[model samples]
Target chain A: MLSAHDVTRSFGGLTAVNHVSLEIGAREIVGLVGPNGSGKTTLLNLLSGFLAPTSGEIRFDGTAVSARRAWQPSRLGLRRTFQLPKLPARMSVLEVMLAGGRLPAGASPWRSLLTPGAVRREEAAFLDKAMGLLAEVDLAGLADHPAGGLSGGQQKLLGLAAALMDDPAVLLLDEPTAGVNPSLRRRMADHLRRIREGGTALVIVEHDMGFIGDLCDRCLALDKGAVIANCRPDELSGNQQVVEAYLGRRRPGVPLRVVAGGTAGAKSSGARA
Target chain B: MLEFCLHVLIMSAIFGIAAVSLNLQAGTSGLLNFGQIALFGIGAYAVAILTRAGLPWPAALLAGMAAAALGGFAIGRLGRDLAAEYWALATLAVAELVRLVALNEDWLTGGPQGIGGITGLFPGLDGPARALATLALAAALLLATALTARRLGETQFGRVLRLMRENPDLATALGHDIVACKVKVLAIGGAMAGLAGGLYTLYLAFIGPDQLLPFETFLIWTMVVLGGLGNVAGAVVGALLVTTLYAGIPFLKDIVALPSDLTGSLRVFAIGSIVLAALMLKPQGLVPERLRRLHAQRP
Candidate 1:
């Protein structure tokens, strides 16, 4: 489980994430939706240890992790995927997965040299584990291929696979369906479902409303870095304030351009418009 | 001619070690250590200083490596939270700082005249024989270094370095202590370079601040780039090829009418040209870095 208490982050004069709080239960797939710069990613960064909040406390499995290093949270079984997958360009697809797992014995330079046979033996086991992860993401064929050479969707899948290697308790995915095709996007939704069933909680920020609608048990909509609504995913459309936070002031007889077919954008304008 | 070739071989072997070290830092970890020569200098000076203090050769060499590792850890600390470009500049500043200290600390470092009467691998051998002996010792060291580097590359540490190189954030999100990883990488690389420096001082029988210039750093960079950035074997190949070009140029004195200074300058120019060509055309170098296969264990 993961929870943030009134998390607020600022940059110079601009407050990026302002007094936002939410909680994710075990095996819960919670959808996080917001307009551009609504502090969705920034909040995720705060929770995932990529950036420290100016004022807030985040707890993972009952431990305060607000000051933890970027790597610390992951070690605590909390992992996050980047908005733009920053996969190592030169590493093999399999190597990417192997890195997500625990550090093996004899990682020190001299020990590695002294017990190369042992290192190799462990590596042989890692190879099999990585192969299985790759197969889950339909990337087994590209295991030996350079990870950077993958398409955007495939890279997303690879990133997912890499995180899955950690067998994390919670995953903060920035945008799971951003560059994916229709079928792959559907597959991603199914994958998230399976992962949720496997007892892994997810906090996903996405513009693909249909995917969010299908995957999320509950949805948290953010506006100006604050939580505007928390309700069942299916009930999200009935929340007038949530719709207004995402779209412009509602006209008396106008059907708003909202959540259009789970696309990357939902033709919405904020209150300023 | 045979003696000249042998001399070139010995020089290449010394350079080969530094190339391999740089590859570990830069190629494997993406650390742009512009102050690598400083670590090299640390070793060279350590050997020169320790040997003058009546220490045995092996002890002196180990001291050199320890000094370099200490210096590297310090630099690595400074490099924490720095971007790659800033880190590179910081490393350059360090190299300059080391050179300045060596230059001003005349009583300690022997200033420009340098320390001499240094021990050799086989002091009694004739020119060719000594060269051959140095080559043999260098070969053994190179073998050990290559195997160690390869083994390091195969371990989880190496994987973390490779992953950390291009994607520090991603590696961090996957449970790597990014700053700590960088520090370890620098220390390991610095130790390897220190060993090379000690060997250089032993083979040349002299060392001065002149030998630890930024130019030496650039020369090593050229080799790593020319042979292939991430490949350990490429580093050796590049070092040998470039060292040969450098060593062979002086022999052109009798055949060509060029002045000695011009010939020396010409070698540098040629080296620059080759690096330029490599960057422009074969940026991956003669051998590019590639991830090792998982083998047929599961495939």
Candidate 2:
């Protein structure tokens, strides 16, 4: 459903994403794994049209979409969630999702003021759709809550629900499980799986190897802004470069420990464990 | 006492309109506009100029609102990319520029002599007609603004505006044309300010550059801050209270033999103290925005 050909982005002299190519098919959950500053999020930004690639071609549903503005790409069914979960502090969770639902295609000021009945009808439909999406993410009860009031994990879920409100053909999520609790993380993974099954293409950036392994159908690893490996989850985990990049070689007598616990320690240890 | 209450109600209704408009820009849109008085000034001048041009009161009032909206559109376009402190500075500059224009523009604004003899909403009728008309006009504007605020609160545009205020980056990523939305709101808000200016001109039967000072801008800010920043009802209440204190404090001089000249300064001092007290006591204003209530209910 989405394709990036030789995408390259640079900041001054430093290249953030270099000649990276990726493809995400409909109903596919593709995992993008990398260390810090590896350009996974940058790649997502370029694809979602938040940042224009210095050089590359991005195609969404067979149309070239590399140079459009962020909001413009959204019309073409390209949606994204930020790594930081950019929820508006002044807006309720429902309002935020309604914003997504009310994408330019759904409402305009002129139409809204002139055709109140039609706008109300569409608004009701959109509200139902937003409510359903919120329920899917277990945020139905928190719909009236301000988006800023959500816990980190809940905000991440709401972010995904908001993206889904657009009825996106492809959703790009940046670090969905980054700061979430383990249970919430697991739920997020499961939700991603359901989203994939429901036929939307997903490209997820994550540091959690377990999440990638559990939720993704295919995985790609990046090192220094370049793709190092692209394969099935098991193969990706075992790939020599991927393993080397994520887990440096242990000394001969240093016992390699795989500490498994909650998300807080896991995140800290996962970085340099 | 009854006269004082009526005066308070009238002044409150006027300020409520200003505060609501200011809140729409600053509280909801997150645009630090320090030049709102410019729009207010334009509104008053529009009415003044149109009335001098022999237009009827109602037509002059609408013309004033249109003028202010046009000014707002100009400012919004000019300050579109400015953020935070820079935006505030730009708006302040614009307000000063407008004031200067009003002061120097002789033929149109009467050039410092000010404009007077402007008729009220009803001219032929005596006390009751004039008072009723003023009250009715004020009520009509307040109701219109309240309805507008309610509609905006529920709409997608309102959500985007709030998102833009909190985090423009997120709003942009989520498919909001932040600049366009800001411009739209700014113009609409300017129109409201203009409406207030028109009403003020009719009520006082005068227009002067002195009314467009930065101090007046701060007064509007004070009203919004006293009322919850994002709460429409809070703005209304705050406007009423502030206007009452402003109009009534002069009576204190009659009771206490304070210097007559000190009344103006004391009234301003009183307003500043009240604002400071409100900030300390209820920093979120009398009625905080509904977002807080929603969030508080969350598990």
Candidate 3:
């Protein structure tokens, strides 16, 4: 469980995230949606400890975590994925997965040199774990490929796999389906459902309305860095302020609930297509 | 001629040690340590000071390594809040500060004249035999460091360091303590350079403020860039090549019939040209680093 109380972040005179409060309950999947500059990603950054808030407090489970640095939150079983998917270009997919595992005792320089045989065995176990996770994502076949050479969809899948390496309770995913293919996107939605079933909470920020609608239990809509409405994914378009925020103006006769394919409020059945 | 060639070979071995350490820091971990020579100088001065104070060689060497490790800790603390480029310039300043200490503190370093008559390993041997012994020792140490590098290249620690080199944020997202990684890397690298410094001082039987210059750091840089950025064997290859040319190029002055005054400048020009050519031909150096792989059989 994670909660934020009236968090605000600013850069110089610009208040990127004005005053937003959010709570992600255990095993709950929440979609954060807004226009291009409505501070969705910035809000995620603040919650995940990438950016300290100008004023407000963030708590994970029950501990005060506002001043903690980026890596600190993950140690508390809170993990995040980058919006643009920043996989190391030269590392193999499997190697990237291994990096997500707990930092081992063999990682120490002295320990690595003194007990190389033991270290080798430990690394073998880590390799096995990473390979298992790759298979879970249906990527065992491409584990040996250079991460940078993978397709965009494959890269996003790798990011997902790497984040899960920590086995965190709370996941903050920034656009996991941004550049993925339709098939992988569908698979990802299925996987996200399974993740929720396994009792892991997720705070996802995505522009793919259909994807968000499919995966999210509840959706939080934003307008000018503040919460505009909190509703079900299917009920998102029906909200009046959310419609005005997306269209930038209210229509005389049009309801603004455009829930067709690729339209603003595309409806997703929250099931495999 | 044989003596000069043997000495050059020995110096390259020492430089090989320094280059290997530099590769671990700058080439793999992406920490630009312009103070590498400062750490090296710290080790040399520590050993020099301790040996003069009646400490044994082995104890003196360990003390020197500890001294450089402390300096590395300082770099980590001071560099935590700074950007990468600024950290590099800060290291350069650290090197200058180190050299100034060695120059002004005549009680220890002997200033510009340098400390001399430092005893070497197997000091009873003749010039040729001593060269062989020193070379053997250097080779053994280099082999140990190389083996360690290879072993690390296969582990999670090495992967994180390599990842940090490319994109540190991704490394962080994976739950790696980036500053902790940097500090450990710098400390280990500084220790290696310190070891090299100890061997260098004993081999030359002299050290001074002149040896603490940033140009010395660049020589190790040239070796790593020439051989390869992320490969241990590449550092050895680059060190051998750079030191060979460095020792051999003076003969070029006589062959080309250049003025004696221009010899130093010509060597610089020649080395610069070689580096430029290498960059043009192979930007990643003679051996580009390969992706680190886990040895698990595909299932």
The fraction of correct interface contacts reproduced by each prediction comes to 0.72, 0.38, 0.65
Q: In candidate 2, which residue ranges exceed 4 Å CA deviation?
A: A62-68, A86-90, A103-114, A247-273, B1-7, B291-299
> What is the C-alpha lDDT profile of model 3 across B1-299, one tens digit per residue?
88888888888888888898889898888889888999889888888777777788788888888888888878877898788999999999999999998988887789888787787567789779988988898888777777777666557678889888888888877788888888988888888788889888877777889999888888888888899888888988999999999878778776888777687777677678768887899878887887655544534
Cand. 3 TM to true fold: 0.93
Give the CAPRI class of candidate 3.
medium
lDDT of 3: 0.83
Off by over 4 Å in 3: A66-68, A251-273, B295-299
lDDT per residue as tens, model 1, B1-299: 78778888888888899999999999999999998899999999999999988888889999999999888888999979788999999999999999888887989899888888887567678677778888899888987887788778877889899988889888998988989988888888888899999999988889998998899999999999999998999999999999999888877888988889999898899889989999999999999987656533353
lDDT per residue (tens digit) for residues A1-273 in model 3: 899999998989888898899899999999999877888999998888888999999999897775446778887888898877767778888888888887575667777778877777776777777787788888888887788888878788888888887788999999988878888899999988877787789999998999998889999998778999898999988987786677656435956565545543332221111
Rank all candidate structures by their DockQ, best first, as comma-separated numbers.
1, 3, 2
Task: Using lDDT as the measure, name the better of candidate 2 and candidate 3.
Answer: 3
True contacts kept of 2: 0.38
lDDT of 2 by residue, B139-239 (tens): 88888987786567556777788888887776776777787887888898999999999888888889898998999998999889898888788888889
Candidate with the larger TM-score of 2 and 3: 3
Question: Any runs in candidate 1 off by more than 4 Å, and if so which?
Answer: A66-68, A251-273, B124-126, B295-299
